[model samples]
Target chain A: MHVSAILTVIGRDRPGLTQALADVVAETGGNWGDSQLARLGGHYVGSVLVELPAGGLPALEQALRCLPDDLTVTLVEVTPEPHPPEGSRFSVSLVGQDRQGILREVTSVLAEMGVNIESLETGLEHEAWTGQKLFRADVQIFVPASLPLEVVADALEHISGEIMVDINLSEALR
Target chain B: MHVSAILTVIGRDRPGLTQALADVVAETGGNWGDSQLARLGGHYVGSVLVELPAGGLPALEQALRCLPDDLTVTLVEVTPEPHPPEGSRFSVSLVGQDRQGILREVTSVLAEMGVNIESLETGLEHEAWTGQKLFRADVQIFVPASLPLEVVADALEHISGEIMVDINLSEALR
Candidate 1:
């Protein structure tokens, strides 16, 4: 049987960190299927997906544990996924003053619309000269196309009006 | 003042989709920012981020109305967003027979852990020879360091065991 594993390496950023991870997986006969490596805030974080023979998991886990303490490892076998009976894709963006209730309010509206938010990212910006606080977010949602688009839009507009922010709902490109 | 718009276009797959989109945005004085376009089934679905002068929205809305009846358009204004608080990022993958509860069960665990999924995609696979079912999902999440890593692993394992599927969580490389 095929056994899938995902390994993450985190430690002070340094050369050879990825090599160390690759070495461990290789030693256990794990096939490195995919990985992502990036530097964030001066720290090195790496994630990899590996496929191994069912018999090789123990060796892989044991090998990973022997690595440095700064590098934490957790593993879960792959699982079955379910497909929605119906779905529609949407894009949502928000612009407003920084406040705590924003995400809750916006996501609540999405939930009521039976929308599944597939991707979301938020960021804060200060006017270079004014230092004024501004919050922004972009979210992509999957909803059923059979639903009236207007209902979703109206819900978002109502929330935007209440929060003194701008909220938009449109079809996603892809 | 700047006005942000989310625009999406979908129709029978054809070559002029991009040009049509660009023409509409250009004529409306809108700057296209982010976009995703792909063919799903026999139709081309596209989503775009655009910024325009506040006064240009009406014209853009009017111009978009000229599209074919099969095309659906949604436009909304939005506010700025702020960055998510700092945290760790992880990758999640699930594979199993296709069904519905998988998303709810898996996301519920993340929600309880204060982990935020950044992006997620799910799909189904059919065995070429046996015609059996296979479902899979890949999700990337941002997890606060304060959340116990073991707890997450356990939750995923439980879901996997119950669903007769596989769930893997690995540290994100970036």
Candidate 2:
């Protein structure tokens, strides 16, 4: 058994920030897993999944030593699901004029259907020709294998009209 | 000075393979850095960036001991460029029916212009209406701060017609 953690750090961007945290993970004999690290608004922001030997070690807390005092750090321990859910992965992509609550509205629909969002990325880009700021979101969703695909398709089709965006839903077969 | 090593491991897919290698990284007091891991054709394949102490233990190469004998592993040491190239990051996204040499053609154009590719990811996705297999590639390129963006844009425009694909070039301002 191993301990799984999602370690997040947000601070000024620099080259060695991840290395500093990774060194701490190593010193504790932990396995650093997949991560998404990016820069936002002149700040370095990232979340990493790390696996550690179950229990013991104030060492991770000591990771504070490696970072500057002002950074915001959050470490959350993830408990493995008693029974990992059975599902199929699908992709949801959105593009349209930037607006408030687009995410909330779209996700509320998914929530109603009992779908699980696996990963979500939202960004803003200029629309070609129009030069308007366009909001785009790409999401990977987990639909219970027992759920009918056509049902989700129908639901997504219904919501696109309400959300006023070009949304596409498709199976992301691995 | 820290050691940056790109370590690659490929074997039959299993859950604990990365853990085994990561344990070794921890034991050697190395820093585990950014990586991309994926399953391709029933194989567990991954490459990890690990920072090691300058020249000492044969530990990494001996990682062979922890993995099954059939697996293939390779380690490449990246020598920091004497003068790391100065640049602005732009994105190149491609979408079209599957074809050979699309990557070759696109990258060759960038190569001619002395543009450096920072990161690239390629995958097969399906076209919505046609239900045809579509090839997609997203690339982050570093255009030397000295290189005019229009020059690259003009070059990309010239090649898109020849390549028979829809390619979009945009600044991915961070």
Instruction: State the DockQ of every prediction.
Output: 0.02, 0.03
CA error at residue A104 for candidate 2, angstroms? 1.0
> TM-score (0 to 1) for chain A, all models?
0.78, 0.89
Runs of candidate 2 with Cα error greater than 4 angstroms are B1-174
Residue lDDT tens for model 1, B5-93: 65555454433445455567777777655444443333444455566887888998999998766565555444443344666778888
lDDT of 2 by residue, A1-174 (tens): 777665555554443454455556666766555444444433445555556777833567666555676466655555444455677889888887865445556766776777765545566678889998776777667788888888888888888898788899987855
RMSD of model 2 against the true structure: 17.1
- The most accurate candidate by TM-score is 2
Model 2 per-residue lDDT tens digits across residues B39-117:
4333444455566777723676665456676555655555453445577889988776765446556767887777765
Task: Report residue B163 deviation for candidate 1 (angstroms).
Answer: 0.9
Provide chain B's TM-score, model 1.
0.87
Output the worst ten-in-a-row residue range by lDDT, candidate 1 chain A. A37-46
- C-alpha TM-score for every candidate: 0.49, 0.51
